[model samples]
Target: MDQVVSEKVARDPTADYIAAIEEHGYVRIPQVFDKSTVDTMLDRVSAWFDKTVQAQSARMPRLNKQQPMVYNLQSKDIAFCRLILQTPVIEDILKHFLNDQWFSSVPAEDPNYILRSFLARSSNYQMPMHIDSFIPYTGSYPFIMQCSIPLEDQTRENGCTVIVPGSHKSNKYAEQSAIEQAIPIESKAGDLIIWDSRIWHAALDNVSGRTRWSIIATFCRWWIKQAFDIPGNMPQKIYDQLSNKEKAVLGFCSVPYDDETRGIDMKRSYDLLPEKVADYRI
Candidate 1:
């Protein structure tokens, strides 16, 4: 067996954050990226958000247009892809909570989780209390998880996130009556806050006189259905810029086959990844 974890903490570097999540259902890691780096990201995001919202407004509703959202950021820029993938210690924490037992798959070495969604959102008003996992279920492992990074300061006045402590284990949907119990989890720009998707949470109303922006992404086990066809929609230029591991996390290693003759294994090892998007997008 592994070392007696309850008695002595594991020597692994991700242990402290893991303990926080096990006890609180969420954790905020401060300064994952320095301000300079964050500033550059924010600049790009600001420009992208404007262009995206303008193009999308032609068909979207008036209310949705006010909030401004850019979906599938991985398809937009390499930097957005790196936001979730290249963060230090994050992958370890996610693996330990979501799917570290890579040997469960046929190849026995490929990762067992994939990025489900990547989007940029801004808050102009409050959101209702709810969970992101879609449906509730009891299990040792969560069906999904989320990470949010603010482009600017996140505080009560600017409409920071609020979550009920330890509520991820509630195994029930969030109740509007319980908003009084939820607490604001404030953090600075570039800081990351990750939570189990089952947690009861809401975004508070923004009254600080400006729109607030946050980059959010959801992750799930490899076999779960993605919000959209990430692998199928990956742009050729963006695909070329990603590393082997990055492509794997984006679902290149587990795309569904069109038919038997196309391929058999969805959980393929990294080496088996196609040299081009055409190889699998059929």
Candidate 2:
């Protein structure tokens, strides 16, 4: 167990974040990136929102019924998203969460798919309670993390994330409680909230009239189905242009014929093409 964890840290120096996740099931790393980057994303978000309003004539409906006050944006716009995907802090955190082998690309633009980007308005907008993991299927070693990056100051009155501490070990999901213990995550724009999926959490009321915008990127083991639609919704041009490595992460590669028989005898070569036989006169 020690060696397994040591190997993970070697891949990236930011292993304490992972240790925190293992021990506490969550970690709020402060100042993972400079304030400028966070501010830039906020600016980009504001500009995009303005453009959206003009294009739709202020008629764009709420993305999800539960999130009327929030708008999901920046799933596309590669120029603005490259920073999120390539941020060293994000990579360090992923190194721990994915156990060193996971790789995922940004989803292309599609109306059917969306990543969670919430802009909370009024201290009264409350998010319904939920756990991120699927109870029935998430067996012993369920590795998943919900990463929240605040774009502005998050206060208790600003709809800060509310999480139930040490709930990851629970086998059954708990019901909403009037007496539920909720930990409010307060941070500046550049801070990160990486929480275990098993922990029950919700977006609580933002009493402040100002909007509290947040960008959330949730990641899990490669085997788990992605939260957002991938190839089905990804642009064809984008899919066709990817390399073998990208395709494998995108779930385009074939699995071995059997579970145990896989890789040992068959040795699924992700880089190798199918064996082709040419027609010949015998």
Candidate 3:
């Protein structure tokens, strides 16, 4: 299982993850899932990756060979859609850090933070140290946060992630000099690693010659434009399988309408979300 090597591990149910993120920029929760579930997810994600890479090979030849990341996963399979629901802790953490002034026709307990992006990839190359918060801003609070879940063991040998602690508050990108401060975060399958989007992080090269796949789902303030147009392209097969909360996170309730004929409000509540996939597209 993934263990926090330097940081004092959170072993109690009431562990202060919010505080951890506030002070250290990230927190790692070891073995949040069981072996069986990890095995199943690894199987599904691997199969999907293989099929998708093959189809997109000609169009994205360089990325296929270099990165091989899959995009718009919510529309591809029920398994990907369900990943968010399986982690209540992630939602709770997001609510505290990201949800505020989430306007609209407000609903009683729907998520205030919507998913900005969701994708899975196997790292084969070294990613330069950088921050996910593209634009620099002054603040300890982050507008975006990322949840990364590994489907298998991650070590320095297989391109484990590395991070510079407490870097989010800098409100700046990593300088080449910061590389000396980066520390490896070795983890096992099913560990949940959440970090402020501004944190400096990168992946090592996979010298092990084996696939090291992980799911990275980015959550942000409701107002931020999701990296993918999920609601516009969410397949009927996937939409039909989602709950009201899931649909909202997938942006079904927040998509802008083409005309006033549909509606003017961009942010909406659970009650406003259409139950049918046919009415999902605005």
Candidate 4:
């Protein structure tokens, strides 16, 4: 069997990643998490999916049974929130691409990268080639990016993601001809694959008998509408537990002013810093 070799310890790949994405529209960082951490996450996700499926069946008489997938994972678990907000390498890469002034500026700009969507998928499923930015209501500029973290090895048999290199620069979706050239990005457990939202990508069929688990998270500029109302849907306790920076990234700072009511309540809702307030004013 072909195996993807990975580092035993985590290291920063920001410089290499920036270059790779600029040139190829995607890059993979190996062993961002240890095997134990990946195993724990996989177990938690499996348990959650089982519970969710049971609850869904109880609520409805007819059930459409299918491979388990849990969306809005950040709201579902604090562990997911920690993974998204506190992962150092992920943060570095996102800041580099989304906030250009990060290196030169002291107390770098927030970038206001909101977690637009997050989900965990397991089982035999294949996604057709598509550009996420082309979805309705998605806006351009300071582009949206997606990060995939696999809890199990991604292989040809387990539906690893296939992507076209340099497709983001094309400024157009892949035609049938271009998609024929897409290549699968085989990776090991704990590997992270980050790609531009404009890149043409798809998932291969999973012929592997066991479930193939992976988490997909998308982040975008604050101005873009999120796939979910993250803050509002979150439990009040979870919302209160997040740090100010985490809250800002999750879009607590992106609230628009009440032009109709001219209300200050929106401002009062969050403890926004001077810089954030200034950015909001613009």
Most TM-score-accurate candidate: 3
The estimated TM-scores of all candidates read: 0.89, 0.65, 0.90, 0.80
Instruction: List, residue by residue over 1-282, the lDDT tens digit for candidate 1.
Output: 111122134466368677777777788877777888788878888888878776763666444556868888999888888778887566877777667575344333434678999988878788878888888666668869998888888889988888898888888999997789988888888777888898888888889998677889898988889988999889989899888777878988778888887777777766777778878634
Residue 245 alpha-carbon offset, candidate 2, angstroms? 6.2
- Model 1: residue 115 alpha-carbon error in angstroms: 0.7
Residue 27's lDDT in candidate 1: 81
Candidate 3: segments with Cα more than 4 A from true spot: 1-15, 57-65
lDDT of each: 0.78, 0.53, 0.77, 0.71
TM-score of predicted model 2?
0.65
Pairs clashing in candidate 4?
none
Model 3 per-residue lDDT at 138: 66
What tens digits encode model 3's per-residue C-alpha lDDT throughout 85-163? Answer: 5577887788778876546456645576788888888889888788888876667557899998898798999989888
Candidate 4, residue 184: Cα displacement in angstroms equals 0.9
Winner on TM-score between 1 and 2 is 1
lDDT tens readout by residue for model 2, 1-282: 111122343565467667666666677777665788878777776676565543432544342333323233323354333444446666556554553232223222101111222232223467756688766133335456667777788888878777666667666674588216767777778777777778777777777877777676655555566644443444544444444444443333322333443332222234442212110000
- Runs in model 1 deviating more than 4 A are 1-13, 57-65, 100-110
Indicate the worst ten consecutive residues by lDDT in candidate 2.
273-282
